[model samples]
Target chain A: MIVFTMLNDRFILATNLSLMTQQTVIVGTLAIAQTLIILTAGIDLSIGAIMVFAQMTMANLVVTSEVSNVAGYGWPAALAIAAGILIAMVAGGVNGFLIVRFELPPFIVTLGTLSIFTALTLIFFKARTIQGPEMPDAMTWMGTTFKLGPFTVMTGVLVMLAMYGIFAFILRNTAWGTHIYAVGDDPDAAELSGISTGRVLFSVYCVAGLIIGIAAWITIGRVGSASPNVAPNINLDSITAVVIGGTSLFGGRGTMIGTLLGALIVVVFQNGLALAGYDQAPRVLAVGVLVIAAVALDQWIRKVQG
Target chain B: MSTVPAILSGRGLVKHFGRVVGLNGADIDLFPGEVLAVIGDNGAGKSTLIKCFSGAHAPDTGTMEVTGQDVLFRSTHEARLAGIETVFQTLAVSPALDIAENLYLGREIRKQGVLGTAFRMLDRKRMRAEAGQRLQDLGIGTIQNISQAVETLSGGQRQAVAVARAAAFGSKVIILDEPTAALGVRESARVLQLIHDLRERGMPVILISHNMPQVFEVADRIHVQRLGKRAAVVTPSKFDMKDAVAIMTGALEVDEADQALGPVRTPAAV
Candidate 1:
């Protein structure tokens, strides 16, 4: 990209980089949660649905009631946001409970929930889109722009970056982090070693839900509205980022920093290709190639043993 | 024979998996500081009995006594807290984690003060240092790098790590489930030597194995299981491997009066 942009100079602009960061606010943040679930060898297909559900919850809570034949509650901004986050966490816990109780695979479970949550969002919110004017200042605060060393940056971008740093540190230096890797590496071995596999798995899903809740908030800030129709391919995008960032889909071998870079790589390819005058087809094709290449690399690395 | 009481004993233990009977009515007695080898055929309830002792399975009808006090284990953690550690046939070591990390996989040391208390930060330097010291103390020199992942190590070295973990924490009892089944002859020798060291340290061990010569070489008393029952308890001196094998296969039956069921060695001797 650097070499290509050397002639065009379109992708090298500070303004373009800042806009790309703002554009990736939602998918990048969701990738943080995705990285965690993938580390446990689990995938969250309902991540986007969960975020949409929670964001719509926040939007519906603040919007006026009876306009769309739905009860909006119209609570205060702070209380409504908290309730949305709690709802996301409960949704995550529900996934955890079903997977642990029935011994169901995470892929199948999360796949079922993706449609469930999407339907729930439409039913509860009446499929209404809440505009920025209808939302409270606290809700759109993440979208607020500020100057940072001659570059315009959204508060949401910095917030997502901070999350990446904090989680990276936690995954590297904590006992819970090591247990995550151990459990992901082999759950039966973890159980015999005295680590409660159920508890670890449950905690992971709950934590993933928490991050999704926050991503919902960031989505409102960056997208400038709360819509159930946004980011239709969200699960695929976040997964693409994780795979491209070099985290093993097989679990227990990835890092948070790699996930952050993975998210950027996806955004960079799309942004860089656009600047180079390539159409959407080529941009999508590049990401598809990257995902396959990354997985093949992961398989080759895993075959080398440990 | 000495009049030494069993350190860990179970009476009339019964366990079933749906319609299949695992242990119909099995009994076991492990004296202190002695290697009591339990031998049985494929369906002779050997693994089932060992699982009950290790708290991996709950018996439907049983009375277990540890130090003469009745105790029932609900989980593997409870059994470990009661001073009984088990090395499962799977070895139960995380393949991706380093040797030191695997050594303290479940029980990890945290950093001191705020880092440990608040953030739950693991003190890697301290854990690695202590793990190295532990390997040295166990006389396991096959693995030198504490940070090397368990998957990169040879089969014997991985077994050594598992045995070291069991020996380090198990103060009262250590149960090894087919510790040598996947190992080569030399690796088997190292594990058998590990059993000897644990016994010399006065830790009672319950060894479940299909190897006849290995059992005869290490066992002070051999318990034969047949058709989900304690067929007979015989000592190495009174009954040879052939008799033990016959009792396991139900080809020979020894009278209760002739069985050498008592402890041949006492805890005081160690």
Candidate 2:
């Protein structure tokens, strides 16, 4: 008890607030998006592709479009963001349509799109990363922060949290959310109950697309460059967070809190490993192993309960 | 004074699957506050008849009335709008979801804000409370939790849950497709009791089963189908297992003895 007291007193509670907040926000956003798709018993293999495509769209607009000059660099950035979201949503709609209409397996469908989207990105940017003018002052304000003594927080992180809060509400308290689970859990039952299983699947992929767009924007702001070859591990990362967060791969069972916690666990482990000077190969291996173990454990628990 | 004009009644219902006739000249009357057991052999038109009524198929020849209003259901959703809900032989219950969640699968309670933005929220508390009340109303006292998955429930309990969900969401008529064909003695008995309870609540029930004892035990009336035809309708007190089996196998005839026992057939083969 004395040691606990000393540790609490010596450690300024807010000292790590800025770092924790931003990191959590980033990881939380990705995890929530992953959770949404996982709950539908679907895997969005193209999330990484969607992200890259969105980024490339934004970059190309800034470099080639007239809006960039008119809005004084800020306009291009804004257009880039909107265009990214639109592209992602369109991709999402396509995903929803194909999966629902053709009754194709999501695995094969998304894999096909992953390649198509990445190839499109290559075609759009001519296989080169387009460097744009600096982001607008107002847009940069979103990435800015102020000091709170030894702590700091970025607006981007706050934005990520706000998105998480909204997503949490939707998952916990919406008819659409319940419908998603219903459709995933039993398509025939859901349809018999008067649910348009097609509509639910459509909405799911579209929403996933929207979330991917948001992720793309954040990613672009952080890295300042859109590269197709980069962030190839994003799909695995987001899926890992979702699985570790306790969302079942089988669908119809998930919680935003679980996803957030799972994301934190993943991000924390990665950061800690890097801090301890672990090599990238070992880090990748560890994360891969952890994902498998989490899934295995979930299955074991289900069997024992049964 | 029949209150609802035979909520769902059909005359000379005929359905053919190209070369095979699923339901041929079948006539059935499903009224409120009663249980009608549609019993037949495996290839009998029970499932086909159910599919037609549930909007999975449109009858090639028949006049169906809902509350005395003539209508042709193009899809299951249409049947649901007319308050005809069917719990399929597959049960149509998502094993992955909990009781309340499954109860309100498609027709979930939505809380809309001003201007109907959907705040997009669900009244989970209301859903749970109503689901609990519905389960209780059906005399299901052993349900451990509303949050417990449907897969965890026994076959009897699962059937009960499916029935309760049908009753809770679909109001006019609830159809059960071989509901108890998968249960044991005690379990089947429990489901039979549930059927009675449903009838007591004034909910019309259409039970499809091949189990003769169960048919005699629970059904207020039984309709025997043989080779896609309405062979007979017998009340439990007047039910004859031999006649039922004969009719199910298309062996029963319009003989002098049959005529003395029930109604006679005019200008028909014996």
Candidate 3:
């Protein structure tokens, strides 16, 4: 896509690059959480909902003026930011608990919680969008950009990259990390091997929640608003990034680096297509096609025959 | 009869899964330094019997003892803690994980210093080195890379990794549930040899198999399970393959007093 776009119009390269990085920050971070859950053979449909809900919470807590009698706590920005992250984490924990405790399929549990969290956010915050000016500097700090050599980079992008690096290391170098792969690969086998599959699963959801909470903060920074309805397609976008990144949706066969590239791939396609004079429909169509191809590719790779 | 006591034993173990009676008062005994092969027809409670012993299921009534002490395993981890390792029929290996990782799937070795103590970082170097040494000990020299994914391995090598895992940590008993049921003939032979080598190490092994010849080759005593109960316990030397099969098919019955039901060997000389 980059080469084709460059051939079409090389002048748009720098603009497209900047737009892609800025656009990918939120989804990129959320994809980290999604990748962790997917690694355990679980899908989280409530990721975007959790982020929006937490962002709303932070926005409402710090709003200095009353809107429609829904007065903000006028609280400190740091506490509100922490509160927002806490809500996101708790929301994530709830998703994990429901799936683990009831043995519910993660798809159904998160699908249901997706509505519940979204609804709760609307009901509590009165469907009001908190503008960027009202939000604390800390809440929008991730949007802060600086020059990195020849590139102008969003701080949120760096945060997402750091998250990827940390989780990649954890997966490669920790006992818990190996257990996650084992549990994801075969929960029954993990159980028989004396690994507490349940504990591993529960912790995975909780840790994924922690990452999602940080994503909430990043989203607030990048989008410059605390709207309950921001990034409506964000959840599917994150899943798309993970799938395109070559992490098997079937579970234990992908890398964190793949997800980063996956997120980049999505943004690159969208930004490149738009710059190449393609309509929004084509970009969406392209991502949909990429998802199918990625999953089909995973199926082929997993059939490593002896 | 040998005067030495049974190293691991189960008395009147009964397990029920919904309405299906898995183990209808099944009994099992494993003597020290002897390979006791557990054999039975389908639904005769062969797997169920071992599940109870391996902590996959808790028998409703029966009791299990290891090294003369009563042990109740609520989970497989508890069973491992009590030194009863089981190589399940499924091989229980994560194919995507590497050889060393599968060997240390549940029990991973952590790194030294704060990186290990606080950060929970794995000692990949130590694990790979030790896993290589273990495969070497098991005579599994075919696998050259400790980091090679198990999916890339052959059936025999995968079986070798599973058995090696059991042999590494199984202090009191190593229970193999049809270790070679899915392997080729050569692979089956290697696994049978693994059972032999484990027995040679003075480890009591409970082998579950349907192959009569293989069972006769490695098992010191054959445990015939019929109708979710212990039909009879006979040694390969005392009863031929036909006799064991007859006992399994319920066409022949051996009185409890006639059963060998004792260890054929003492401590390992090797």
Candidate 4:
């Protein structure tokens, strides 16, 4: 109630609302990917790094330089973007392969890959930022907004929604989805039931990679630049949103709708804090509080329901 | 009497978990339309032998034949495809999912159109209906909502769901690993009834349990495993509870002549 009054007095409610939707696109997209991984009782710390690396690839490919003009030499925008997404998928596939083939834990595997991907991004881009005028309109297309009622919605927001919609259907109404939940719930039970848990987990990681790549494109659009240094804490932020969305970190019990709400809650809190003159410290502190509160709430609900 | 061919047989099955011996030349033969109870003290290779048959573990040295044809199982999925299903002691049911979803966890039915072929949409309505029907067929009509999550169900209901799933898909044989180890007395009785139902349906069942009453109640032939091998095979009428326990603990031994005589009156039985 106090926050609402402050917003009304400031009269920047509409602006804040629009900014929240736009802000949600990046973290919200990452949370979707995180949802899949967490559902399998796994985590991917490399999500943000994978997104950044893919964005850099997209940026460097289209903004041609003398030394980096391999594919940028008159390459079509669609082809470059496709190649960027493919590169992200390949990186994700490698993570899956290492995990399943070697029987390593997802935590350690993704942690190692996170550093490797970040280093690869820095080495490839020479720790440089690709900025305005060099970025093509095709790459920045997601930034374009249209009026919906009194609200201005960005194309990236629509893309995020569309992704959520497609995956919601898949997770709720498919054999693969059931297998995922089964594998996450109890791997031994799943194996005895004849579900190939390794294949399920491997596919989940790869599909999460695909979603993260799409997020990379959205990140490029939102920032209007491809920078290695942007959203460095995005990995933790995505996990925060997922956990706050009521998805259990332990796996097998969450919804896409909950994740979307989680993303909205995060953006709303940050926006409200900034509007009220609170600095970055309070904003980060608030997110940490929300994460713990959400997990505690989940435990309570489980006990009551069980 | 005409002989019935065994649906599944293992000869000299040997398995070792690292340095510990799980099975030592364990041999088993599962006849058709019979409930063969494999019971023993804890860690007497009952589960190991079942795992070998169900493809969860490969025998270090042994040969398995399904319906008289030798085959090798690389994984549980292969064993399932070859018409063998196992309900592990853990119940092997995903608690978060609904009863219908758990029923069709690994083998979900898909829609018969482009939505299924291209998009892989599941036929949820059909699956739910079939799941309900399957449970009812197994005489488990107490489950009112097929969409209720398995975690919400009672212990007996969950066990019923596991048994129903095995009975639905297991074409050749269903191997149950202590299906009632965690159930209440009433629930245990319900499970025993379900086992009897499966037998009446002509589905061979391999019941692994520590409960002597349950073993004697439902099992047509009891395979007493001792020291990682078959100690003796006896019917409930031939060997009383005392004799069965004595044989399992190696307190009583049957000589070759007495074994050849088959179900002879032992001193303990008197």
Candidate 5:
């Protein structure tokens, strides 16, 4: 109530609220993917790097010389997008394969991959940004806005929501979802009960990679550019959203609804702070405080319930 | 007792864990409609033997036969497919999931149409109903809510869920590793009764336990393991608790004279 009162006092209008929802697209989609990884007690620090790499792949494939107009065929925007997503999935597969086959820790694996992918992005794109006419219509289509009853919503926002809805169903009412929770809860026990823990973990990484690919597309649309430097803090931000949404960092306990709400809370906090005349430094500080408080509250809840 | 062939058997099973002998040439046989109690002192290779049968660990050297067919299991899923199910001491359940979900953790029932084949949706309603029925069948009526998370249940209830899961899915054989080690007296009795019920249904059961009275109360035949090998296989009517304990701890040895006494007319003194 106090925050709402402050926002109202600052004359924050409905348009600002709609824009805040729109702003949630990129981070929100990434959070969904992060939720899946975290549910297995795993973390991916290379999510931001993967998304940026995928976006660059999509953009450069469309703009490069003979690559765009190959074999007497016009530039294929759809092929570029598919290739970008496929690359992201392969990257995700690599992470899963190494982790599962070798039994390596997810944190260290993703940490190493983060540096590797960032270097690849730099080498491939030369740290250049693709903007304006260089981006094809198919690539920028998600950025277009559609008006709905006194509010303008971005297509990208709808796509994010759809991803959340589809995955929420899959997690709730599918055998694969139960297997995921089982593996996260107890890998040895799951294996004894006839679940292949390696297979489940490997598939989770691959699926999360596919989601990150979609997040990359959203990043391109939201920023109106495919820049190697985009979403530098997304890996941490997605983790924040997932943790704030009531998913345990230790894994095997969380909900996608909580994640969506978590993403929204982070966005709302930043937007509200900016509206209330706080600088960028204070906004970042507030988010830091919120993350700590949310986790502390989660610990308290666990103890109380026990 | 019915002259039925051994449904599952292992011979010359051996497993070593970095200089610690898990199993040293342990052999086991389970007949139909009988409870074969495997009792041993701590580190007597009881767990190692069952693990070999349940596919948790591959024996360094051994041969396993299920229904007279030679088989090698590289994974527990394969063991389950071959009609061998194990209820581990840890219960092997996801506590955060509901009772129904835990019951169908790996082998969930799916919808019949495109919703299942294409969309991969589960038949939650049917699963819940069947899980409820399975619990009731095992006389686990205390769990009023089938949808309740396993973490919220008591220790005995958790054990019941594990036993019920094994009994429902286990076809030829069910191996239980210390099913009542963590339960209260009443809970242990309930689990013992479930074991009896499984035997009555003619399903072979391999029960690994340290409790003497429970073993004497249920086992049709006792397999004493000592120093990572099967010391002797005797009936409850032939050798009493003292002899079983003496053999398991290696304080007493089984010679040809005792083997020739056919049911051992007199109980041997420790």
Candidate 6:
């Protein structure tokens, strides 16, 4: 009985580790879209706003949009995803237009849109939070308890892994991926090589918006409600994961695997610190230190190679 | 002596930067299995002509033909489709990427899945192997690893890789602008040999240079540009560096103005 109990204790610890791992993966997928945007030598300060906007839009659609005439559960779910993604695309598209067409610096453009998108999100909710429908029996299956051996995994985890895999494939295999790297490295040079830098930037922002939609889906499923004010520090965390993952903020010098590793590091450290009773101040300090260290290490590696 | 449609030919090419004439009524024929050197002082429209051929800017006037077919290229991709690749003086390579990755930067070959899905990603193994082989074929056996990023390569070696990429991608006509302008004597000589080797493989090469010795060394024919027009096409056997300079600076024509001032400038596209 003692031996069996020991084995069960060990199994529980392992399961907890796996659960943390799943959460890190979820965070990593959200960071990836941002990583890509940064890789193009551009910044998307509005990622947080975009993510929240997607969540609020989808939550309202599912709950308040009433199961009126024709469309039912299946249709609502699909339409919610589609609408969330579409809204994000339009938001991202506006960002793209301001940057590409107006010839404005991406930093200023995104900074302005960051405020605009947040305001838009608040407008959607009428300055109030949206409570998503009580997890439907079928929809609840996605949020159902998952077990891999002794470890429980959420649907969010699986979806994150799948998205990461897709991202890795797209970055590695497709011509579009090549164009992304090309545009990020040197827009003028890439243009000379026949890669449309503006188009690449536009597409990246559009894809970024789509990823926000996916993130919203996962967030709603995880929390069972959409609050615009939730996780105010998420944007910073996402950026921290991306930078620590080894994707250069300067662009054209990062990997999805690196970013995933980075996200895991960020989450694992934060969770472990929390488990050990560290305060929020120390956690924030560590993340800031991590960003600096990653950037310095990258520059050192580049210099050494030279 | 032999005809192959000049590989790439520009007729009546005109480009203007809002009244500042970059290239005005210029024409040039780049022949395969030969090096045609374009030489002039600054503002002779050499860069403009090269850019037009490379699809950087659409010519405001004139036609570009490749392999004898009139092509209207709006972008470099169009020029690439017609097997015309240009190695700009800036090199335009991603120093962050490895040698092989840079070589296959745009035209990466891969496996396809059912219904045209991308299954096998970037055939990297094959690319590395082929990149090695191609480099060796171009007489570049000194590179230890194709995976080493280009930032690690020497100036001459980077230029070699750039040229090798253009050559490997099936560029029938390779246009290089001042490729060795920044290299030292030994490095420049090494680059010149690569240019010569390119010709031996039946690929037409356009070598744009300011160095007369270097130009006379590799070029089979030298086309001298004087004030946005090609004034002379002289073979290496009958070339005079001083006379070429005089033509390039329009000094020869100025000297002849006292004797007879006529449009004797044939405007030949060599």
Each prediction's whole-model lDDT (CA): 0.88, 0.75, 0.87, 0.85, 0.87, 0.76
Q: What are the candidates' individual DockQ scores?
A: 0.78, 0.60, 0.84, 0.79, 0.81, 0.44
Scored against the true structure, residue B133 in model 1 reaches a CA lDDT of 86
Expressed as tens digits, the lDDT of each residue in A95-114 for candidate 6 is 88889999888889988988
DockQ order of candidates, top first: 3, 5, 4, 1, 2, 6
Kindly list the per-residue Cα lDDT of model 6 for residues B1-270, writing each as its tens digit. 233346678878888899899887887877657788899989998988888878888889998888788887888778888888888888878777778777877777674554135354677777889999999988886898999888789998889888887878756788899999989888888889988887776677888999999998988778777677776677666557887898788786433222211111122322
lDDT (Cα, tens digit) per residue for candidate 3, span B93-192: 9999999999998889998899999999999999999999999998886798999999888888999999999999888899999988899998898888
Q: After superposition, how far is residue B161 of candidate 6 from its true place, in Å?
A: 1.1
Residue pairs in candidate 2 whose N, alpha carbon or C atoms collide under 3 angstroms: A173-B122
When 2 and 3 are scored with lDDT, the better candidate is 3
Model 4, position B150: C-alpha lDDT score: 94
State the TM-score of the second chain for every model: 0.97, 0.87, 0.97, 0.93, 0.93, 0.88
Fnat value of model 6:
0.44
Give the lDDT of residue B68 in candidate 2.
Answer: 87
Model 2, B1-270: lDDT tens digits are 223346677888999899998988887777556778898898789988877888878999988887789889887788988888888888888887788878887777765564125485676777888999999988885797998888889888888888888777668888999888898888888888888777776777889988888887777767777778777776666547777788678777544233222221211221
Best by lDDT: 1
Structural similarity of chain A in candidate 2, as TM-score: 0.85
* Candidate 5 local Cα displacement, residue B227, angstroms: 1.5
Q: lDDT, candidate 3, residue B32?
A: 82
lDDT of 3 by residue, A1-306 (tens): 746567567525665577678888888999998998999999999999888888888888887775423588887888988888888788888888888889999999999999999889878887888888876688799889887666788899888889999999999999998988888899999888888888888888888878888888888888888887799999999999998888877898778999999998888777777767789899899889878887787678657542
TM-score of chain A of each: 0.95, 0.85, 0.94, 0.95, 0.95, 0.88
The complex in candidate 5 yields a DockQ of: 0.81
Better of 1 and 2 by DockQ: 1
Looking at model 1, the pairs that clash are none
Candidate 1 docking band: medium
Error of 3 at A125 (Å): 0.6
Candidates ranked by TM-score, best first?
1, 3, 5, 4, 6, 2
Q: After superposition, how far is residue A182 of candidate 1 from its true place, in Å?
A: 2.0
Lowest lDDT 10-residue stretch of candidate 1 chain B: B259-268
DockQ-wise, the better of 4 and 6 is 4
